[model samples]
Target: MTAMMDREAFEAALRQIGAERYHHLHPFQQMLQNGQLSREQVQAWALNRYYYQSQIPVKDSHILARLQTTELRREWRQRIIDHDGQEASEGQPAQRGGIEKWIALTDGVGLDRAYVESGAGILPGTRFAVDAYVHFVQEKTLLEAIASSLTELFSPNVIGTRVRGMLEHYDFISRETLAYFDKRPVQAKRDSDFALEYCLENARRPEEQEAVLNALRFKCHVLWAQLDALCFAYVAPGLTPADAWQPGTAEKENPRS
Candidate 1:
């Protein structure tokens, strides 16, 4: 059997998975960051990505439920709140959540919010990949589930590149429209720091450490698979699924343009 790695080595191994397999390296993401895709392609991306965005809190909720300690649950609860937002109180204004911000992004890209939320037109590949992620957290051990979230360790950099590229290259993309990303780097850092600490401390045995590493790899694949679906359906031969969203169909007037 393989020997257990020290905490430092195990953390390094986890980061290595993101370096090797994160979707930031995908061709579709590269084109997106470089301003190579067309307006319709960008719209398609926004619309489809909304599905993933909406499900993040759901995934986190599953993790929160499995946590045994109030301390852990309290930390995990912030993830759901970050995505779901808070309601207006007697004296305070409502805080916009990540999902609402993402909807605004879709609106900025000219997709009707209702249509995007309906999930009626997303690719089968996207649905399957995202659903798999949700199920993974629900079924896996708590350590593995938290380890899967280690993907966030790599997101701040990619978000920076994407935000810059879209603003520079796409006339239809605005910093306001892409607000969902602006706050993500900080949030991702906080969340990932906690998750990484949890994973390192919990994965005490060799087999457990290996499981943590594999969980991170699986998450990378989940993200990569979503981009693969986008590239295949939108960028290449463009054989969009019959039921999947078409470029011009169900679009609103692009005010940003």
Candidate 2:
């Protein structure tokens, strides 16, 4: 049997997975961050990505259910709250959540909110990828589930580049439209730090560590696959699926326009 790696080495292995396989390196992502895509392309991206964003809390809920301790559950519950937001009550205003903020992003891009939320127009690939992730969280070991979230480790840099490039190059894009990203880097950092610590501490055996590493890799594939779907459907030959969202088909008034 292989010997287990030290905590530091295990952590380094996890980060290496992000360095090599994260979707930030995907071609579609590069085009996006570099402002190479057209408005329709960006709209497609936002519309499809809304599916993924909406699922964040669903996967987190699966993870929350499996957590054995109150402290762990408390920490995990915040993720759901962050994505789903709090309801308005007796004395407080309703705070917006990540999912709502994402809707605003799609709205900013001129997609009808009802259509975006309906998931009727999303690509088959997007639905499959996002659903696979939720199933992964539900079926995998808790250690693997937490390790999968380590993709957050690389997201801050991607968010920074995407926000800057979109604002500079896209006439249709505004900082307010991109508001979802403003809060994600901080939230991702906090969440990734906790997940990394959990995986490093709990994955004691060599096989367990391997499972943790593979979990991150699986997540990286999930993200990369989403981009691959986008690239196929929107870029190059642009063979959009028969029923998927077609640009200029079901759009709202561009607030920026």
Candidate 3:
């Protein structure tokens, strides 16, 4: 069996996972931040990323269902509403539902709404990694599932970097087009803070602490792999999956312009 880690060491390991494997370091993200991607490349990114955004509530619900404590479930359930929104009659839709805003991003990019929702054109890696995350939450011990979500602890910084970089680099992108990220940093902090406190208080042993740290690492890989797949498939050209989106399937020309 693996050796156990204390609280300090466990926290350090989680931070190290963010440092080493987060998508911020990926070359695709660097290209995006530096204004190197073409308009088509950005569109491809938005369309594929919609899949990830749509899956968040499903994963959160799975985690919530697994929580035995009423207090824990109550804490976890808000993340679902944050992403899915609890609109009654849906006049304008809720102000902060992440899913509706993600669709708006795809619309801004000029992708066909149906194409994005069908998920037929998403990369195999994106599907595999995202599904794996949901599965991990459903199948693993509830403690580990909550611990895996600690990726949100690092998300706010990434969201800031992405928003600023997207605006600075892409003249075609406006603040409005990128609105999906505006609320995420705050939401991520709120969700992750709750998850971190839950894990820290519940994981009483050195072994459990180590498992929690590893779970964070696994979640980091899950996020990183999605971007890496995008980089390899869309950025490089001719490397895209057989079923993934093409250069002009939804529309011809740079839709952003």
Candidate 4:
């Protein structure tokens, strides 16, 4: 924007970016949420997505390492804990992180956890998109990095839609299987509130505001690109990309795993 917007206007602009460009609007997401995809296709989505889920803490850690204040680090460290899990204490069992919960979802869908965790079957496009997101956080200004995380603002609604739709349509999907989403809405709100407030406070110049807006847009592209790759390779054209997972192949690696 040529003129810097007021804080409310800036937040509105960010939400507009999510409305117009978020992956929830993508065809592959529609197919997965609405149960238009087969079980094998769902397996593929879960397995490939495990890479993204696993890397969340890695991205957050990069951001945490760069924060200059203990208060900011304290505020941000919960994100890492939420994804990576806190270790067990004297009386408590170890809590599985989101990555582990995602593995449960994969297992619920009949995939091998070791194979999924190996990143052995992930698509090229998926890897590229997730790596770009991590690098965006690592290389960008702290303000821009925080801005990119504002995608969390729109996630609660999409997660609700996905959880409900998957439960209603897929017999194999149980509440327990989709448990990874159970706490996400609340966690996302906490994270996005902190991120949005950070952006509003830090982005003071007109050019800075524009950069923040563009950072969010870039984050949206990271999401949209993953679905685009998935649809072309597995959903419509149905041609698995070279070296990517194929559901029915008899190779010893077993892409379906």
lDDT (Cα, tens digit) per residue for candidate 1, span 1-257: 99999988988888888889999999999999899999988888888889999999999999999999999999999999999999999999998999999999999988887799999999998999999999999988999999999999999988998999999999888899999998999999999999999998889899999999999999999889988999999999888998999988887766544
Instruction: Note the clash tally of each candidate.
Output: 0, 0, 0, 0
lDDT for 123 in candidate 4 is: 89
In model 1, pairs of residues that clash are none
**Highest lDDT model number:** 2
Better of 1 and 3 by TM-score: 1
**Candidate 3 segments whose C-alpha is farther than 4 A from its true place:** 1-4, 88-93, 252-257
Better candidate by lDDT, 1 or 3: 1
Task: Report the lDDT tens digits of candidate 4 across residue range 1-257.
Answer: 49989989988888899999988999889988998998778888888889999989999999999999999999999998888876799999888788878988887887876778888788899999999999999999999998989999999999999999999989978898899999999999999999999999999999999999999999999889988888878887887887887885312254234
* Residue 172 in candidate 4, Cα distance off native in Å: 1.5
Model 3 C-alpha lDDT per residue in residues 147-235, reported as the tens digit of each score: 99888887788787778888898877888888888888888899888888788778888778878887888888888898888888877
Superposition-based RMSD of candidate 3 using all C-alpha atoms, in angstroms: 2.6
TM-score of each: 0.97, 0.96, 0.91, 0.95
Name the regions of candidate 1 deviating beyond 4 angstroms: 253-257
What are the RMSDs of all candidates, in order? 1.3, 1.4, 2.6, 2.6
TM-score of candidate 1 versus the correct structure, residues matched by position: 0.97
Better of 2 and 3 by lDDT: 2
The lDDT for every candidate, in the order shown, is 0.91, 0.92, 0.83, 0.88
Q: Which segments of candidate 4 are over 4 A away from where they belong?
A: 249-257
